[model samples]
Target: MTETLRKKYRWDRIGLVLGGLAIFSFGLAAWVAPEEEQVGSVLEHPNNAELPESIPALRVQEIQTEKAKEPELDEVVLPCSCNRNVLKLAKNPYSDHRRAARNLPNSFFVKDSNELNAGKRNGKLVEVKDGRGFHISALSHSHAVLLPEVKALLEDLGNDFADLLVGTPSEGTRIRVTSLTRTVKQQNRLGRRNYNAIDEASTHSYGASFDIAFTDRPDNAADCSAPTRAIQQVLSQYQKSKRILVIPELSCMHVTLRP
Candidate 1:
């Protein structure tokens, strides 16, 4: 009977331990249930091991995107002093261009596109391209061709222009040639579109002239003051020497090679 009673006591202790473990497990489940439900909440995002991205990193990116914006209205852009003192620059008359375009030693009328192409084939009109101090812009209404002598003159002008600006802030600045040789058809089209177009045949139609619209400095390393002055000095020297005829138009500086 004593042995039987001892066996009963051991079983009772085992049952008590099992019951306590069941209660502990139930309490743990109750504590985790609320946390699991709140895992997807916007305001209470809990750390999740299964997430593909770092939770902290994603939050930082979102904050940055929300704060991103365009430039402010009052943001100041420094102005370049290109116009000051450069007003003394020559503004040549257009009538001289008309006279020189027809009478210049190398000038000849390019009546149409066919004549323009023929001039090119016969080596009368040479191909014009970028050189030392000048660059040809995308020509929309003109051919990239000029009289051989005219081309040479242009090259000399470019080289001299570059030399004049050497060691200055506008050292690498280049004059932008906006227009080149234009046929009669192209001239008419331009006349219809542009109010500044010449009333009669343009000097460009004769492959004797080009237009300089802007001087651009690479990298904005310097302001326009140096480039502007350099242009004035170079063009004025050429004009005074009677080597070229010029018309300082509203859009560009029209230049014609003079014999």
Candidate 2:
């Protein structure tokens, strides 16, 4: 009876150990296995994966948040009031302006940016900035520069313009110089769009001309009449004196420094 009881106890112990081993192996398999939905979700966001893109992105924004640049005051063309009814000044043709422009001291056709830079370095051209009487507009197709004589003429004109309106409501009015020296390339480009570029070549390429588009008032203290009359008087005096040639264009007054 004792021998049979020992045999049964040994068999029972072996069976219990085998059952525990099977349960542990099944639990480990369940823990290691992943669902199909989990793998698809991970693939959707490749950027969040272990590696970056092999090919770089083109036209990708350098800055995530950047403001658009705003245009300058001179970049925008203002409406002009100078015409037959207003100002009523003498009108010079592009022919006359070009003729005078071509005859200036050491005058030569400025064909490109290289010539322009050489002119500036050798004193053929002088830099022009916003001064007392006139403020240079933000030039897109032109440069803020002129011949020494032309710059002097511009300064004188500004002084006279301010003097004329002394004690008047338009005392602080300023002439808006819209255009100045331009390269031949710039002229050719403008000619396609600007009817005023009627001449085969523009005087602006010689740094001998400028355009006045508006008489900017300091305040609304007075109407444009006073300022308009002042422009008429000054421009007329200069034109009659043969000091400067003028072209009364639809949008602006083109003034050339006479040779």
Candidate 3:
């Protein structure tokens, strides 16, 4: 072959090889680039811009963002059960009628009149005849009986009465017991005169309930209500402590022992 023709052929081969290498380098660059930066084999884009959404990926991101933005919920609490009145009057929360007698302690119920009468015969009861610290009601329920424990309760209440009367003109005044133990028959008879008589669960039959007289004067005299307020305060303290339940009636405080 001639020298010039051979040189031209060599140069042509060299150009072909260089062009192939350039094409290969561009393809490799596109393969190694991030998916967001590569649109197609020939196209490239800046990574700083947001890409168009794929349907599945977009839904997943939206769900994640919603979960993060949602508020967390809090736990809830319940209320107490005792919430009704007994005497058709405004309920004394101290003596909530919702209480079930089925769960009451054994000492709280007399079971039947026979058991109460047995208590009287067994000296488990004591006569609360009028004496130094208290007075009995003038009503037909004059002969009142109480459990020994309850009699002791009255004696302890005398101290509360004294504390109430402290620095007052009525200091050392005796408290009056308005009602005491009643037979089932007595309770049934009294039910006619009193609407609060519940023979089945009556603590009076058990010798565990008692009534004290109170009067509120609109005049608001100092120490005039000390007896009434003091007794009520003491009874309320006991009621809050869960030792007894007190019903603040129109004219008296009816108390029942926890036992």
Candidate 4:
């Protein structure tokens, strides 16, 4: 009986040890298995999943696009008769003639009254009627028959010249008659004959010509104070641009069309 009891006790001890080992193994498996599963699940879903298309950097690219679309400014086209370096005066009708006269060469001066009258008959002189005169002619020359565009331009030039005389700015710069085809007498260097000569087949013949004489003083009437330097600057520019012809002389300029 003693031997049996001892054997039973030994067997009990062995069973306890086996049970403890089984419990430990189960606990380890529960903790480690869950950690492995969590790692696998994280690996399946990447951080970038469900994202939309690639976004562009608008700050840099948009500015570049806008800059490319900007319009260029118009270039200054100088008249051809003057040197290319000269700057063009603004197309202000009131000041254009005065500015033009100031820019014209000294060679262009009005001859004596008789010479001018002779030139008027020979198709060499262009007589531009003032607004008042032009209005009268307009009644006779139907608007449909006349070249409106040319006429408008001449009228604009005339108005501009008148404005210059009155010390106003040219607001409406246009041409009325492009080429009137009149005649005038030109005096020679010696000032002897007043023959019907084409002083200049100028736009002036079309009533587009204007003369700029300087004022002597605030109230003085006879003397002139035309600025030669300023006029030359203008003529130089026109010559370069091929807009008009400039003849430089003592006190006046003979300005006319380029051709």
- Winning candidate number (lDDT): 2
Clashes of each: 0, 1, 1, 60
lDDT of 1 by residue, 81-156 (tens): 2221332446556666777778866567898978887888888888999999988888899888988877887888
Q: How would you encode candidate 4's per-residue C-alpha lDDT over 105-149 as one tens digit per residue?
A: 321233345544454455334444545112212321111111223
Error of 4 at 200 (Å): 11
What is each predicted model's overall lDDT from 0 to 1?
0.76, 0.80, 0.60, 0.37
lDDT assessment of candidate 3: 0.60
Candidate 2 lDDT tens digits, 120-190:
99999889987765788888999998998999889988889899988998887888898898897788788
Worst window of 10 by summed lDDT in candidate 1: 76-85
**Candidate 1 backbone collisions, by pair:** none
Whichever of 1 and 2 has more TM-score, that candidate is: 2
- Predicted candidate 4, C-alpha RMSD: 23.1
Decide which is better by lDDT, 1 or 2: 2
In candidate 3, stretches whose alpha carbon ends up further than 4 angstroms from where it belongs are 1-117, 131-133, 215-223
Greater-TM-score candidate between 1 and 4:
1
Write down the lDDT that model 1 would get.
Answer: 0.76
